[model samples]
Target: MLLKSIRYSLDELIYLLNQLSDKGYSKSCESLGNETIGEHTRHIIEMFQCLENSYDLGILNYGNRERNDQIETEIEFAKQCVVEIRTGLKSENKILYLEHVIGGLAIRIQSSYYRELLYNLENCIHHQTLIKVAVLKFQNIAVIENSGIADSTSEYRN
Candidate 1:
């Protein structure tokens, strides 16, 4: 079940990648949000890279080492992260599971080692929602399901 969820999330993340690829940085905002699509993608990359480094170092216990405010480029960052994630998954690491405290929370780290991949996807979704909302607000763009702007008879779809 978890694996399925992971795959689904991964697919969703891929879809988000497509959505974000065509988005321009012209979207104006007073301040960059904590988790924009680009930042979220970068965070996933960073998280995967950290996991890969820990796997390589055989370090069972690890810590969060966030050294930057946020990553602004999503496409290139996602590409790098996807490569690292694939490499890490292909490697033979039985002890990929470990318990560590993060944000003062003791979360159970699963051994299947697939959680990282899924988390990446889930995190992307978490940020994409924010991005979508921001896009709506920033551009004042209306979202219509079947009939798009062609049906301009609606009041911005509320």
Candidate 2:
């Protein structure tokens, strides 16, 4: 159920990537506080990568992501990364610990894989919303309807 939505969200990104150029991918958007679309895309991919990379350890620390630059600088690489994320996203739900350092304090919380997956889905959509704006403003492109919108919001609007 959730995986389907996650796939759909990733597919939305793939579609957008088809229309984006390398320059557009890395171009800074004045509307988004000079942040580039690639930066946001990198963020979206890394969060999921952090989850997948640490799954075997039964612990997750999102802050420990690689912050890989290739995914953000190259549009083709970003597309490939998104496809890899879609292909790699398969796991049975299990109890996991979420470790995070907040304001010099480190903490761990018990969380399930499905819960974290849901969080990642939400995080992806949040970034997509911003990406949609940048896409529109940067290139005057028409984003797929509801691509960046929450499912509930899309339902409500209809």
Candidate 3:
């Protein structure tokens, strides 16, 4: 169930990316300090990749992400990365630890792979919201239907 949810979130992003042209993907928005939609998409993909890479290491540190520029500017590359992440999530979930730093102090807490997947899904949705807004402002492109809204929020509309 968790993996399915993660895949759905990733698919939502891919669908949105597919609808954009190179200009829409790379265009910077003044409202967001000139940050492009590609940047936001890259950030979302990297967060999921970071968690996947650390799944077996017993310690997950989200701060240590590779912000690959290629993934940001290359729409096809970002789609491939999302596919890789979705494939990686097919494995069985396991207990893991999350490492965080608070006020110069490092803290490690117990967590599970499934929980981290949920976190990534939610994070992607939040980033998608920003991307959707930027895309709309940069061009008259139609945003993805329910791209960033949580499922629970949409359920109430019905």
TM-score of each: 0.49, 0.95, 0.90
lDDT of 1 by residue, 1-158 (tens): 54444334444445445544434422334344434556655555566566656664444343564534334554645655555555445334345665587898866555534555445445645554555555554443443232111122345565
Could you tell me the TM-score of candidate 2?
Answer: 0.95
- Which candidate would rank higher by lDDT, 1 or 2? 2
Q: Name the TM-score of candidate 1.
A: 0.49
Residue 145 deviation, candidate 2, in Å?
Answer: 0.7
Question: Candidate 1's error at 20, in angstroms?
Answer: 3.4
Off by over 4 Å in 3: 138-140
Task: Mark the 10 consecutive residues where model 1 has the least summed lDDT.
Answer: 143-152
Candidate 2 C-alpha lDDT tens digits along 33-80: 999999999999999989988788999999999998898889888888
The TM-score-based order of candidates, best leading, equals 2, 3, 1
lDDT of each: 0.49, 0.91, 0.84
